[model samples]
Structures are given as C-alpha cells and as structure tokens.
Target: MRNWESFLRGLLISLVALVGCWLVAGPTAHAATSAPQTPTSPPTSILGINLTGGFTQQPIDSNVISGHSVTLSAKGTRNILETATNPLGSRKYVWWESTDGGSTYQQVGTNSTTYTFTAPEVTKDTPLMFQCEYDFTGLGLFYNEWSRIATVTVTPDRVPTTDIQVSADSNTLYNGESTTVHATLTPDNATDPVTWTSSNPSLASVDAYGNVTAANTSSTMDGTANDHGTVTITGTSNGRSDSTKITVGALQNVTVNEGSDATFTLNNLPDGMTVANWYKVDDGTTTALNSTASSYTVSKTTVGGDNGTAYYATLNYTVNGSTKTVNTNAALLTVNKSGLLSLTAVPNFNFGSTDVASVSQDNTTLENLDEATSGSNYDGNDNGELSVMDSRETGGDWTLTASLSPFALSDGDTGQLSAVILDLYDPTARLDENIPATNTATKIYTSSDYDGQTFDVTDSQLSFAADPKITAGDYQSTVTWTLSVAPS
Candidate 1:
C-alpha cells in the first residue's frame, strides 16, 4: 500500500506539469498550421531600367554634298510597371549628343520615345555620337544606364582647285571697236563658269561672255577725235586667273587758208611715243618739217606754193624695248592768186533831232562793183557781206579807209556836237576786225579772196555824240570810204 500511494502521487505531479505546458504551447502549434504564403520580390525593383532601339553603330552619310538628316528612336521595356499611373515618368527617354569624340556631351532630346538629329555643315570627315537614357519616376525618380553610343560619319562638299587661262582675238583695238575673248580651263571636266574684268574700265570694258569693247580715256562722244588708250583684261575661274593686254590708236585731219599759218596735230597721241615728225610732199619729193613736236606749223609766206600739196605726220614709239614708227593720213593745202582792189561808200548818215548828252547812229549801204562779175576767181559765196574786193593786176592784200567830216546841225552851230567822234564796225570782217574812230582816213576792211567780185559794205554804222551845250536840231555827217592794195 505505501508503494502504490507513492506511485500515484508521482503520476499526479506529472499530469499537472503536462497541463501547464499545453496552455503555453497550444497557441504556438496553431500559429504553425496556417496556409503557406508566397515569397515577396522586394516591391518590383524600379531601378536598373534598360533602354533599347536606337542606332547601335555608326551610320555613313550617303548624300554628303547636299546634306544629311535622320530620325533616331529608343524604347524602355523593363521596369515599366509604374507606366500606368505615370506614363511619361516610367517610359521617359532622353537623348544626348557628342561631337568631339565623346569628350563633351550635350542634351539633345527629352521626355519622348524618339528623337531626330541634323548635322551641321561638315567640310571634311566628321563624326557624331548619340545615346539615350530611361527614367522611372514613380519610386524616388530612378534612371537606367545610358544606351550604347551611336556614331555617324558625315562628308563635306566639293571645292574647285584648277587653273584658268584667257586669250583675246585681237591684242590691239581702235576706239569704238570690240572683240571677243575666250577662256580655257586645265581640266576639261570642270563645270565652273569663267568671269571677266578689266584693269582700266575707262580705257576698255569686258562683258560676261568675254566680249571686250574699247573705251576712251577722256570723256568724249563715240565719233570724236582724241578717243583712245590701252587696257589689260583678266579672266577668273575656280579661284584661278590669267590676264592679257591691248592697245588703241588715234586718227585726225586738218585744213587752212593760203597766206595763213597752217598747223597739223596728232589728235590722241598714245603713250610711249618718243618723237613726232611732219612731212610735206610736193612733186614727188618728201620734205621733213623742222618741228619735232606733236604739232607743226607752216608760215603764211611759205604756204602759198601750190594749189594741192599733201602733208602728213609720223610718230616714233618704243614697243617692248624696240623702236617702231606709224604714219597718219595725208592732208591737202590750197593757194590762190592776187587780184584787183576796189570799194564803194554808203550814202551820208543823217541824225534827226538829237538832245544834249544823247547818242544816235545811222547805217549806210555800200556795194563793191568788181564783185558783181560772174565766174570770178574768189572762193567766197555771194552772201551780201560787207567786203573789200581786190581786182588789181599786181594785186596784194588791200584795205579800205573811211574819212568822217565833222557833224553840223541845220542851224550851223560849231560846238561840242561838231567835234563828236564817229565809230564804225564792218559786220562782215573775216575775223571780226572792226574799224573805230572814223575822223581820219581809217582803214575799214581787208580781203584775201582776190577776185573780180562784188562786196557789200551795207552794214556800216556812223554815230554822233551830243553835249549839253550843243544844238538840239537835226545833224548830218558824210563818210568817204576809199580802198588801197596792201603791200606784199
């Protein structure tokens, strides 16, 4: 009995200990029997995004001469779960460009899936680099690694580098003339057009198609003398050029009277002319004049030799260190013979009522009777001019004289009015030579057209001066005109 009772007490103590353990461990066992749960993927990582679909390698320019342009595109596929709430932020792409072999970078595109790039003017082999970046902004604004770099090769335009030469049809041209010029390039395949220019536009001008026209150094009309010079023409093409030279010549003519000085001139003497000579050709003999200037003159006494004598001029010049000579056209000379001398006087000049300190004039009519003969030896026309005619057999230059008697009024008062001076003008004098103070036998007119012809002194004028104390009645004066031959 004592042993059984001890075993029972031990059993009781063990049971009590088992119940206390069950209360503590029952919740732990229940927690372990629940359904299995899936492992978490760390909130679908938004970082480490990837970009694709752009130029993976360098592209060569095909149309280099004109220019080149292309479109570049990129896409973001991974880490795009945030695109539904923020489409722009999740799939955003940025483009970057590098022109100096990636030494520097520049942002070229943003907030888009694609981009376009245009190259600047490239004169040589040029390289360009491009890349793209993907962004995920939903979770702390994350960015993906940059895309693989893309390269592009651009070519440049072509330039000309050949030589050009030019030539003209004529190296020498006269004023108011033109010639055509031509140009030649070394390479026959060159397509560049040639341009022309003149060193002296006043001396010569050139047109676009290479037509060269001669111009005058001085500002003169086309058909006048003294219109000439020299000029240089140049042609250019493709940065290359050449030049040529041309010369222009001058021309002229002259004439003179029998007993007057005759002069000849080289109208437009060209440059480099060292000397000039004048020559007279008579009866097949050439005589050199004593003058070496551009102009030569012959005296009146030496010019009355023949009716038709030829005179010419020659110019000496240096061309490329060599002496050269050029001749001008011949000019003709004329001489005439001496004839008779005569004159006619106009009627008395009468002044009507004249006041003191007043002036008046009267014209007379005078005609040369010898000048009325038909078929005369004179070279002047019958223009009714006041003239002196020389018809003497031993004829020479002649002159006409006028003697004006003192003016007297009808009242016969010899006062200051009577001493009034008379002046006359031969309106038809050869060189506007006039006669003044007609109180003495003053020479009036002279003529060298020695012929038995008539000349009219109808333009003669007589004047009267009135003093304060002189008479105021009608006054009259007589003018006596006479002619005499001039000594040779």
Candidate 2:
C-alpha cells in the first residue's frame, strides 16, 4: 500500500507541469494550426476569454512602384454580446515589418487602423512582409495574437531621360520678334529638368524657361552679321539633348536690269545642313537647279526671260540620331530692260586720188571711215568699216540699199564718163545672214536672228571703165546709201 501511494503522487505532479507548458507559447499570428481555441481550450482561446473576434480586414498583399507610397489597412471587430456582458478590455493595434522572410520583425506603426509606407528605390529580390498585432493588456484577461502576414512588392518606374526633342513656336523670326520653345521627354516619367541654351546668342537669345527673342534690326551684336543670321536653340536633360534651328530673317525678292547677273541669297541660314539644294520655280513649274550655294547667282540674264521667277532651298540636318529637312522661304526675281532698234555705225569708202584715167581703173584697198579716215562715221563694224547693232528685246526686220551717180569732170570741161561699178564684196562677210548685196534694196538682218548683237560688213571697192574720148582733169562720183525698215 505505501508503494502504490508514492506512484500516484508523482503522476499528479507530472500532469500540473504539462498544463503550464500550454500557457507559455500562445497561438500563432494566424492561429497557425487551426481556428481560435474556445473557453474550454485554454491554450488558444484569446487569453482564455472571448470579448472580441479576430481581424475582420487584414493587410492584403500589394505591388507598388519605387518612390511611391502605398496604404495598408486592418480592422478588428468586437463580440458585442460578449463585450456587453463583460466590458473588461480595450484593444490596441500595432503594425510590424519584416525584412528577412519573417525571421524577425520590427514595429513600424502603432494603434492605427491604417498604415502608409513608401516603396524602396530599387526592387528587392524577395517580397517584404508585414503584419498587424492586437493586445488587450488593461483587462484582467489579456488577449494576444497577430493578423496574417501580408506581402508588398516594389518595382522601379522613375527612369532616366533617354531622349529629348525640342522645337520652336516660330522657326522663322524677324528682328525684334519673340518666340517660345517647347520640349518633349522620352518615357514621360523622367525626373530630370531640361536646360536651355543657344548656339549663337548674337542672332538669338534664350532664357532658362525656353523663351527666345530675335536680335533687333539695328543691333550690331555681331557686326551686322546677327541681323540676318541663323541660330540654334537646344534643350538638354539627363545627358540627352536636341536642337532646333531658327532663321532670323525671311527671304526677300530682288529686281535687276536685264543682261546682268542677278544674285539671290538666304540670310541667317542655320548650320549643319547636308549640302543644301536649290530649286527654281518658273512658269508654275518647279525644277532642281545645279547650284548648292545659299547665295546663288543667275548669269547673263535676258530681258523678261526670268521675270517673276522664284527660288528656294531645302535644308537637311541631323539631331539626336534623327534626320530632318526644312525649306527656306521662297525668294522672287525680276528683270527689266528696254527695247531698241537703231543704227550704231556706218562705213565710208575712200578711193586713192588719180590725175588721169586710161582704160580701166579699180580701187581694191578699202579704208574705214573713222575720225582719222577723213570723216565722222556714226556706225562701225568690228571686222569691217560697216557697223550695225540691234538692242531690241524681240525679233525685227531691216534693209540696206545703195545707188551711184555718173562720174563727171571736176573742172566743168563738158566731159562725162560711164561704165563704173561699185561692188560690195562679200556683203555677208560680217553681217548676220548670208544675203546677197546689190545696188537695189536687200534684207540684211532681223532682230530675231541677231538679238542684242551687232552687224559688221567689209571689203568694198570701185571698178570703172575709162572713156575713150576722155578729157580727164580730176574726176569724181557720188554714192547714195539708205537704211529702211521692211526692206523697202
């Protein structure tokens, strides 16, 4: 009987130790093993009392971008029936965050139904963990447990600016004109601020805000070069930049006389162009010219030939790995000249003096009638003694005729001589057309054939037969010449 009594006492002590172990480690934050324990089950029954239920709304897993904030919320409900019967405790809520997959936790928020936190700058390899805990310590029966663990995922979104495009409201500006610059950034969410600059401040100036103003007309900022010069406006951000060209002045039309060279220029042309191309617009037709110069000239212009002509240039450039093209304003050209058709120079023939004539006398050598040739000659020829010019703008017709009178004795000795011929040797030698020359009228040249040019004729002589009963004392003859229109 003594041995049985000692064994029963040892068994009772062992049972008390088993009950103490259950109270040491409470339920998991989620009641990890199963549902909350009841009043009869001491280890999991909300500190052995039932005044409130577990969280009705716990923190849910969420995703957020870097540099942005996210809100977390949780709520617990009271067992009104149980709480009214025993209003013993007020609960306190606390939030916690764990970085190491829930290995340990640190308090981040307390006594709040909601918590807001910012996302990290870079995404983490593993998701972050968060939880909410409730405590009812003031009441005689204390309750302790935590809400289910929630996860937060973060990702980076504020990327650096990769490209920037800049433009101007007015690409072409006059002196004293103002314009604004606009810029666009790639990826839209970039955080870098754009800086503004000007390539040539003398032609144009810009402010930090991208506002631009053109140089004044009278300004000698760059020794009169800025008055009509090109300038570039650029915007840079995050090591990326883009530029736009602004033409300071517009193109102008010019007027010039015909038969002269005319020059057309584009003032204030921007740089970085790829071998500009010039185009001429004539009679409603646009054709490409061989010229590539910004200041181009049309050589030896004709009267009204290029009147009302317009020219323009295509400017191609590169910016930020992109190619772009622009055209300068059209410039017009006008040519003016008057029409004229009048004789310029004429040739006079001189026959060498002879005392007496025998059978036949001929003068072959021809002398031009200039200041030193015996008389004043109005019109002259380049290769000969005869010269004619037609400065008319269009085509015209003209004729030259000649006649001879009989030779007579100079001393009035009642002597006469005949059979004299004045041959105009190779009249077409220097004239425009190959027309035969005779004593009668003949068509020489027309403005259409030799416009804005001269007509010259040479090689004329006199051939005469001596009179048998000749009483020669010095002989003379008269030759008549006439220039008439329409070949009359």
User: Which candidate gets the maximum TM-score versus the true structure?
Assistant: 2
Write the residue-wise lDDT of candidate 2 on 369-483 in tens digits: 3232332332333344443333454554655555655666656678755565655554444443321223334344444453443334445555555545656455555544555
For candidate 1, the clash count comes to 12
Q: Give lDDT: candidate 1, residue 470.
A: 56
Tell me the whole-model lDDT of each prediction, alpha carbons only. 0.50, 0.58
Q: What's every prediction's RMSD, in angstroms?
A: 37.1, 32.2
Q: Pull out the clashing pairs in model 2.
A: 229-268, 344-379, 345-378, 345-379, 345-380, 346-379, 380-387
Query: TM per model?
Result: 0.23, 0.27
**lDDT tens string, model 1, 1-488?**
99999999999999888766644543221121122122111111101111121211111112222265555544445433333333544345667767777766677777876676565776676767666655333333333434556555555643353977778777866454456566766654343557789987765778665766665333222212233445779989877999888765443333444334666555444445534777777766778876678776665422235445656666675433556565554555554433324442133332223334453233222222323323222333333344343334454766666676665554566643434444443344433223333467766556655543333433433443434455555555555667677677
Instruction: Report the poorest 10 consecutive residues by lDDT, candidate 2.
Output: 39-48
TM-score of 2: 0.27
Model 1 scores a TM of 0.23
Q: Mark the regions of model 2 whose C-alpha exceeds 4 Å error after superposition.
A: 1-250, 338-432, 435-444, 448-488
